[model samples]
Target: MRGRTLNDAFIILDEAQNTTIAQMKMFLTRIGFRSKTVVTGDVSQVDLPKDTKSGLIDCLEFVDKIKGVKISNFDSSDVVRHRIVRDIINAYDKRKK
Candidate 1:
Protein backbone atom coordinates (compact mmCIF):
# COMPACT_ATOMS: atom_id res chain seq x y z
CA MET A 1 0.00 0.00 0.00
CA ARG A 2 2.39 2.68 -1.19
CA GLY A 3 -0.26 5.40 -1.04
CA ARG A 4 -1.34 4.38 2.45
CA THR A 5 2.15 4.13 3.90
CA LEU A 6 3.31 7.14 5.88
CA ASN A 7 6.42 8.83 4.54
CA ASP A 8 8.82 11.33 5.98
CA ALA A 9 7.78 14.97 5.74
CA PHE A 10 9.71 18.24 5.61
CA ILE A 11 8.84 21.25 7.72
CA ILE A 12 10.32 24.73 7.84
CA LEU A 13 9.90 27.18 10.68
CA ASP A 14 10.37 30.73 9.57
CA GLU A 15 10.17 33.93 11.60
CA ALA A 16 10.06 31.91 14.80
CA GLN A 17 10.55 35.00 16.96
CA ASN A 18 7.55 34.43 19.21
CA THR A 19 8.69 31.02 20.38
CA THR A 20 10.10 30.59 23.87
CA ILE A 21 12.82 28.09 24.74
CA ALA A 22 10.27 25.66 26.06
CA GLN A 23 8.11 26.06 23.00
CA MET A 24 11.07 25.37 20.75
CA LYS A 25 11.87 22.17 22.57
CA MET A 26 8.24 21.08 22.42
CA PHE A 27 8.02 21.80 18.71
CA LEU A 28 11.19 19.87 18.07
CA THR A 29 9.89 16.94 20.04
CA ARG A 30 6.54 16.94 18.25
CA ILE A 31 8.02 16.00 14.91
CA GLY A 32 6.19 12.99 13.51
CA PHE A 33 7.97 9.74 13.02
CA ARG A 34 10.04 9.75 9.83
CA SER A 35 9.94 13.51 9.57
CA LYS A 36 12.64 16.18 9.28
CA THR A 37 12.50 19.75 10.55
CA VAL A 38 14.40 22.89 9.76
CA VAL A 39 14.13 25.88 12.06
CA THR A 40 15.35 29.26 10.94
CA GLY A 41 15.23 32.62 12.67
CA ASP A 42 17.22 35.80 13.12
CA VAL A 43 18.11 36.60 16.70
CA SER A 44 18.66 40.26 15.99
CA GLN A 45 15.23 40.71 14.48
CA VAL A 46 13.43 39.20 17.45
CA ASP A 47 10.14 41.00 18.05
CA LEU A 48 10.06 39.96 21.67
CA PRO A 49 11.21 42.39 24.32
CA LYS A 50 14.91 42.48 25.17
CA ASP A 51 14.20 40.79 28.51
CA THR A 52 12.53 37.84 26.81
CA LYS A 53 14.84 35.11 25.64
CA SER A 54 14.22 33.68 22.20
CA GLY A 55 14.20 29.95 21.61
CA LEU A 56 16.21 30.39 18.47
CA ILE A 57 19.03 32.06 20.38
CA ASP A 58 18.87 29.54 23.16
CA CYS A 59 18.94 26.66 20.70
CA LEU A 60 21.92 28.10 18.93
CA GLU A 61 23.85 28.45 22.16
CA PHE A 62 22.98 25.01 23.56
CA VAL A 63 22.09 22.74 20.62
CA ASP A 64 25.13 23.09 18.44
CA LYS A 65 26.44 19.65 19.46
CA ILE A 66 23.09 17.95 19.22
CA LYS A 67 23.03 15.18 16.62
CA GLY A 68 21.24 16.00 13.36
CA VAL A 69 21.32 19.69 14.17
CA LYS A 70 23.45 22.02 12.13
CA ILE A 71 24.22 25.65 12.90
CA SER A 72 24.97 28.18 10.24
CA ASN A 73 25.62 31.89 10.61
CA PHE A 74 24.56 34.67 8.29
CA ASP A 75 25.60 38.30 8.46
CA SER A 76 24.65 41.54 6.86
CA SER A 77 26.02 40.31 3.56
CA ASP A 78 23.26 37.74 3.50
CA VAL A 79 20.61 40.42 3.63
CA VAL A 80 18.49 39.90 0.53
CA ARG A 81 15.90 42.47 1.40
CA HIS A 82 15.58 46.06 0.25
CA ARG A 83 18.81 47.68 -0.82
CA ILE A 84 18.48 50.15 2.05
CA VAL A 85 18.33 47.27 4.49
CA ARG A 86 21.76 46.07 3.54
CA ASP A 87 23.01 49.59 3.54
CA ILE A 88 21.53 50.23 6.93
CA ILE A 89 23.13 47.09 8.34
CA ASN A 90 26.46 48.04 6.85
CA ALA A 91 26.15 51.52 8.24
CA TYR A 92 25.52 50.12 11.68
CA ASP A 93 28.56 47.92 11.38
CA LYS A 94 30.66 50.91 10.48
CA ARG A 95 29.35 52.78 13.46
CA LYS A 96 30.45 50.01 15.80
CA LYS A 97 33.98 50.17 14.41
Candidate 2:
Protein backbone atom coordinates (compact mmCIF):
# COMPACT_ATOMS: atom_id res chain seq x y z
CA MET A 1 0.00 0.00 0.00
CA ARG A 2 3.04 2.27 0.14
CA GLY A 3 2.78 3.27 -3.52
CA ARG A 4 -1.00 3.27 -3.43
CA THR A 5 -1.23 6.58 -1.63
CA LEU A 6 -4.02 8.79 -2.86
CA ASN A 7 -3.25 12.38 -3.64
CA ASP A 8 -6.72 13.83 -3.31
CA ALA A 9 -10.02 12.85 -1.78
CA PHE A 10 -13.44 14.46 -1.71
CA ILE A 11 -15.86 13.78 1.13
CA ILE A 12 -19.49 14.64 0.79
CA LEU A 13 -22.00 14.28 3.59
CA ASP A 14 -25.54 13.89 2.37
CA GLU A 15 -28.80 14.09 4.26
CA ALA A 16 -26.82 16.39 6.47
CA GLN A 17 -30.14 18.03 7.03
CA ASN A 18 -30.81 15.35 9.64
CA THR A 19 -27.68 15.82 11.72
CA THR A 20 -27.97 17.36 15.17
CA ILE A 21 -25.70 20.19 16.27
CA ALA A 22 -23.55 17.85 18.37
CA GLN A 23 -23.11 15.23 15.64
CA MET A 24 -22.11 17.90 13.18
CA LYS A 25 -19.39 19.12 15.49
CA MET A 26 -18.06 15.57 15.94
CA PHE A 27 -18.02 14.94 12.19
CA LEU A 28 -16.25 18.20 11.48
CA THR A 29 -13.45 17.17 13.82
CA ARG A 30 -12.77 14.06 11.74
CA ILE A 31 -11.39 15.95 8.73
CA GLY A 32 -8.03 14.46 7.79
CA PHE A 33 -4.74 16.19 7.20
CA ARG A 34 -5.12 16.67 3.45
CA SER A 35 -8.87 16.29 3.30
CA LYS A 36 -11.49 18.99 2.87
CA THR A 37 -15.12 19.15 3.89
CA VAL A 38 -18.02 20.19 1.73
CA VAL A 39 -21.01 20.42 4.03
CA THR A 40 -24.11 21.08 1.99
CA GLY A 41 -27.69 21.10 3.23
CA ASP A 42 -30.76 23.20 2.81
CA VAL A 43 -31.87 24.84 6.01
CA SER A 44 -35.34 25.15 4.60
CA GLN A 45 -35.38 21.37 4.13
CA VAL A 46 -34.20 20.52 7.63
CA ASP A 47 -35.67 17.22 8.88
CA LEU A 48 -34.81 17.75 12.54
CA PRO A 49 -37.58 18.27 15.07
CA LYS A 50 -39.05 21.72 15.45
CA ASP A 51 -37.11 22.35 18.65
CA THR A 52 -33.86 20.57 17.64
CA LYS A 53 -30.87 22.56 16.46
CA SER A 54 -29.08 21.44 13.30
CA GLY A 55 -25.33 21.26 13.23
CA LEU A 56 -25.27 22.87 9.82
CA ILE A 57 -27.36 25.73 11.17
CA ASP A 58 -25.19 26.48 14.17
CA CYS A 59 -21.86 25.93 12.40
CA LEU A 60 -22.42 28.69 9.88
CA GLU A 61 -21.68 31.46 12.33
CA PHE A 62 -18.78 29.59 13.90
CA VAL A 63 -17.30 28.57 10.56
CA ASP A 64 -17.60 32.09 9.18
CA LYS A 65 -15.36 33.35 11.94
CA ILE A 66 -12.70 30.70 11.29
CA LYS A 67 -9.78 31.74 9.07
CA GLY A 68 -9.81 28.87 6.56
CA VAL A 69 -13.47 27.89 6.52
CA LYS A 70 -15.31 28.96 3.40
CA ILE A 71 -19.02 29.72 3.44
CA SER A 72 -21.21 30.22 0.40
CA ASN A 73 -24.86 31.24 0.29
CA PHE A 74 -26.95 30.45 -2.75
CA ASP A 75 -30.38 31.88 -3.22
CA SER A 76 -33.17 31.72 -5.77
CA SER A 77 -30.83 33.25 -8.34
CA ASP A 78 -28.48 30.30 -7.91
CA VAL A 79 -31.15 27.66 -8.21
CA VAL A 80 -30.32 25.18 -10.96
CA ARG A 81 -33.18 22.84 -10.22
CA HIS A 82 -36.47 22.78 -12.03
CA ARG A 83 -38.08 26.19 -12.31
CA ILE A 84 -40.82 24.99 -9.99
CA VAL A 85 -38.24 24.32 -7.34
CA ARG A 86 -37.13 27.91 -7.37
CA ASP A 87 -40.71 29.05 -7.26
CA ILE A 88 -41.36 26.85 -4.27
CA ILE A 89 -38.30 28.21 -2.54
CA ASN A 90 -39.44 31.74 -3.16
CA ALA A 91 -42.93 30.96 -1.94
CA TYR A 92 -41.60 29.61 1.32
CA ASP A 93 -39.40 32.64 1.79
CA LYS A 94 -42.42 34.85 1.44
CA ARG A 95 -44.41 32.89 4.00
CA LYS A 96 -41.54 32.90 6.54
CA LYS A 97 -41.92 36.66 6.82
**lDDT of model number 1:** 0.77
List the candidate 1 regions with Cα displacement exceeding 4 Å: 1-7, 94-97
The sequence of per-residue lDDT tens digits that candidate 2 reaches over residues 1-97 is: 2223223556677767779988887777766667777888888789888999888888876789888888887899899989998899899899999
Q: What is candidate 1's lDDT per residue for 23-86, written digit by digit as tens?
A: 7777776666687778888776788877889988887887878887787788888989998999
lDDT of 1 at 27: 71
Clashing pairs in 1: none
Candidate 2 regions exceeding 4 Å error are: 1-8
Question: How high is each candidate's TM-score?
Answer: 0.76, 0.83
